[model samples]
Target: MTANPVYEFTEREQHILKLLVDHYIEQGTPVGSRTLSRLPGIDISAASVRNVMGDLEHMGLLKSPHTSSGRVPTSAAFRVFVDKLLDVKPPEKGTIEHIRTLLDPSLNDQALVKIASNYLSNFTRMAGMVTVPRREEKPLQQVEFLPLSDQRVLVILIISDDDVQNRIIHVQRNYSKDELAEFARELNEVYLGRPLAEVRDRMRKDLERTREDMGNSMQRMIDVAGQVFGPDEAEDNEDSMLMAGESNLLGHADLGDVSKLRDLFNAFQQKRDIFHLLERCVSADGVQIFIGRESGYDALGECSVVTAPYEINGKLLGVLGVVGPKRMSYAQVIPVVDVTSKLLSAALNMRN
Candidate 1:
């Protein structure tokens, strides 16, 4: 949710302010009082419009660039406009059908997520992003351990009928092939049908309980099981984020500074910060808008982010959004994001 700035404005002041903002957004340049006075519904002289513009500047809602007598809206002004002034309408039926067609339920999870990101970028002409769904732990079907040279053991995991995973663990001492097989057999007997995370916890507790009287072979087996069932960093990376059309931001005049553009692209490449920002929106309801400097990240000080969370069976999977210049058409982008999330959620539910 965007916080609305508290500022009182008379009917004439509000009318001129809206005119100035609309003109500036369309032209990407400062708007002078004469230009606004000539617009429809002004019913005032250029001099009177200039006086109102000066008052708005004093309120911190507008600023005058040194190069021009015209005034442009400040970030504060955009916040007020988005929260109270702007009227949002539903997306066209054609757009909703296009999005629905692109997000086909028959596609795999990765493909579906990629399509969603592309749709956001193509529709809004901005950088689009989507976080991969967090995987749930599945019950183990079988386990195997094979001894290798140089104190290494290969742990094979059968998570389901068709899912198999392999991991390598280094040990303090080399064990014979027969000993490794026996260790795997013992672990499978106790943990074959349990989820991997729960199995790891149970193994740790069993070790704590039997530590005083356990023999060397049993202790070694427990240690091996711990390594085999631990969190896999490589697997976690698979669930990070997918992005498309980042270069579209390059075409935005407000974001043309070379240093700022480089930093923004770097932030996208190193997704930790952006991922954390999107993660905060996972619990938020409906669409969220973050105008310039409101995103709280230096890289996004000149940009706006619109995001919505997508889910299946009412369980949140992740967030999807677009990053663009602050002057973007929120009336269009907001509905696209809102509808895309719903379509993505419906497609995922169908796939499941």
Candidate 2:
């Protein structure tokens, strides 16, 4: 639909709709009139509530599942509730401190990956996941060459934002470690702190113009560098991919259907899809929420994502986000995700 339809509701209808959505989200079961009447100040007969619920179902706001005699909110009902009724609260101060304190300062990248995933898992009480940040937009921070064989050199790249990338380039002829060191120094002086997108093309033009007369090894080194470090132009194949937390969304009661859950998981598995999603996330600074079917991913049509972009010194570097059932506690998760993204940026910027 192009726009959410405005449903004209009486005070009772509004109260009943909110109650049904809240109860369903909490219990993951159809809500019956009797259960709703027990709420404070309801002051309504079971028959009256049932009549209003039937009207809601007819208006496409609720559904009665086959296995139960109660009603549950449909995607449309949830969308309406999210748009008009949700009262999101920030995570409590104690909870925020617990999350902050749980992050150990001593972990290396790999260790941090595991620790982060576990930490998020515990905090969300859902699957805690994180994806490694994309390295393509990064600027060159440092480069080193390690000699492994007569002709093989490992090109280590330390990029902006503490991201490290390495590639092995084989020289056609062996050079002394002195030559490698000289080349590394030269490369650093010319390209250090330059954006990666500018790095290769500038070098290629320079090398092609000046080094055409050079030996085959020098030419091949230039060629290999171009091949290995190219920037991604497509939405899919960009720099980011999921690093952890694939299993968390499956536990949401709303995603109990295997087919829908599989589709959601499959979307995360596609590196390009996740990268595009993160790219979109980083395009904005604050928490961005994409509800079910709101995100562009077809597989994610049944889920919602809450993401925040983190930065270093005003430059956008990466994103941290969570995907869960559409019934996610946006009030609680948004601030927590926001704090985590800031922590990540601060930590990375400190390292830099």
Candidate 3:
């Protein structure tokens, strides 16, 4: 097989490449040159088709399965197809409304997260993940203490917006329920309705000031809170989270590589890595398409992520996107992810 000489293929190579990828995608198997010759528009002999197949293989666009005399499209070929040949269209209004309905106010955060995860999985035919906003981000509205034992107390933290967190503290000495109430009153008087971060800081400073004068019981309570609300020591509070459709990648022939699946699972366990990958999904603005190696995670090098930022009152807060195998039909997934993200932002803003 001769190299087509033109940097771009002679028209014949273009048609052959498209047919190969499309057939492979539909059948989940390598496509042979004989099948290529049988498709209309390319008036070429089986031998000639084989020649072009060889040329595409040389171009690193196709790979041969050791067991078969056929070729499968590589990530490079998928990238080229998305960039030049994929025909994507916007999602239908009804579909968008359905998505909005699923995210309706009637559902609580946990329910919504689950439903959204299912929706992404079904719609994209891939694994879906959704991370609910952490409760700590909400302000602390109230506090109460319940005595569990002489030295154990259950401290309940409430946020004004119907969010709650509970922590258990151990004291060197026991305090009666009345004493717990009195302590709760004092704490609330000092810090209720403040952001958790602020409340935490003030409590820490107050504890530091009173440490020497305080009795062991009160000091132990303060110590527990200091640990609970202390400056985050985990590098950073990961505000952004992921909900992914991991199952969606399973049936694809391209993902047959065991190493690829292993790496992908490892990447999934590292939320920071996924966050970093999605971070690139929102750049200077507009919908971003990151194909294969462009996603920056080598494990995801065989996948593509199309994401757009979601906002509240024009302020960008986070991004929502889809992660699919590189062979994903970008034309379909892009619009679905893009419009869904906008809907999410709109719904969020309405609550404020």
Candidate 4:
């Protein structure tokens, strides 16, 4: 973990390091000097390759797990590989179609976020997550009130793109059907298509003005509408989101240590911290790579997260990514995240 960013690596060192890392990633094994010598363009003998690996180990970029075995790149080495030595490849045609097919435009945002999570997991063979967008920032689309028992009622909220959600609450008294309809009409009249927070603010102003001039019953009804839409404060942009493929992580041998796996599952179960991390990526210009300990979470020390923020116009909607072992194929997963973000963004923008 040399922090100053080693820019002094020579051409030979870079070539050998890239060859070893690529081999280790593809084969999922420690790379010996013998393996390096077999690389297509490499003309060096095993002895020469050993010298390079020993130099890399001394620099703390690689590690020897045993006395005479192969060398494994350290997290520092991975940082160098991803940041400098690696060459990314275009996503395969099937990868693009997987994204397009799963994230269908006909689906709602919620459904597609779930799909994105699953697709990332299935494609990358790791855990995947997409933070739910804060959609309440827009004007409320429609409102309705339905009655069940004498004292119970359902309040429905329709936001952008006809996304409908409902909640039930109990009231002190019962109202007739006509009375309920009148209340619904009044609520729609005042707050229809207005931002929920703005509606709350405007209601406060109107309430103060009408409190003195209107009957107590009308004032009470307005208070009820305020209670209906005011609970969430109009912020749907949440760190809370959907995740699929957590079980997939359990299958990775790198996470086979029962205790660390348990801890990783616990971290995923309590998503607030991970969401905070995802929220940080929303401001990054492109894909953000967190390699192992760089994530600042111990449970994720053996993992890597590739996250990209998706947006509508310039407004960031949410972040999506694949979570896998530190040996994940960056060339493959990067484009998956990058393209999925764009697709998710385009999907959201279509609602406008």
Question: Residue 101's C-alpha lDDT in candidate 1?
Answer: 97
Descending-TM-score candidate ranking: 1, 4, 2, 3
In model 1, state the lDDT of residue 255: 93
Whichever of 1 and 2 has more TM-score, that candidate is 1
lDDT of 4 by residue, 81-119 (tens): 999987888688887776777777778778878888888
Locate the minimum summed-lDDT window of 10 residues in model 3: 1-10
For each of the candidates, the C-alpha root-mean-square deviation to the true structure, in angstroms, is 3.8, 4.5, 6.6, 4.2
Stretches of candidate 2 off by over 4 Å are: 1-12, 41-55, 104-114, 145-153, 160-164, 170-182, 198-228, 231-253, 261-275
Compute each candidate's TM-score over C-alphas: 0.82, 0.76, 0.67, 0.80
The sequence of per-residue lDDT tens digits that candidate 3 reaches over residues 271-332 is: 77777765554433857777777766688888777777765556555566677787776667
Native-vs-model 1 lDDT?
0.85
lDDT of each: 0.85, 0.70, 0.70, 0.80
Candidate that scores best on lDDT:
1
Q: Tens-digit lDDT track for model 1 on 35-65?
A: 9989998899999999999999999999988
Pairwise lDDT winner, candidates 2 and 4: 4
Give candidate 1 misplaced runs (Cα > 4 Å).
Answer: 1-5, 136-165, 171-222, 231-239
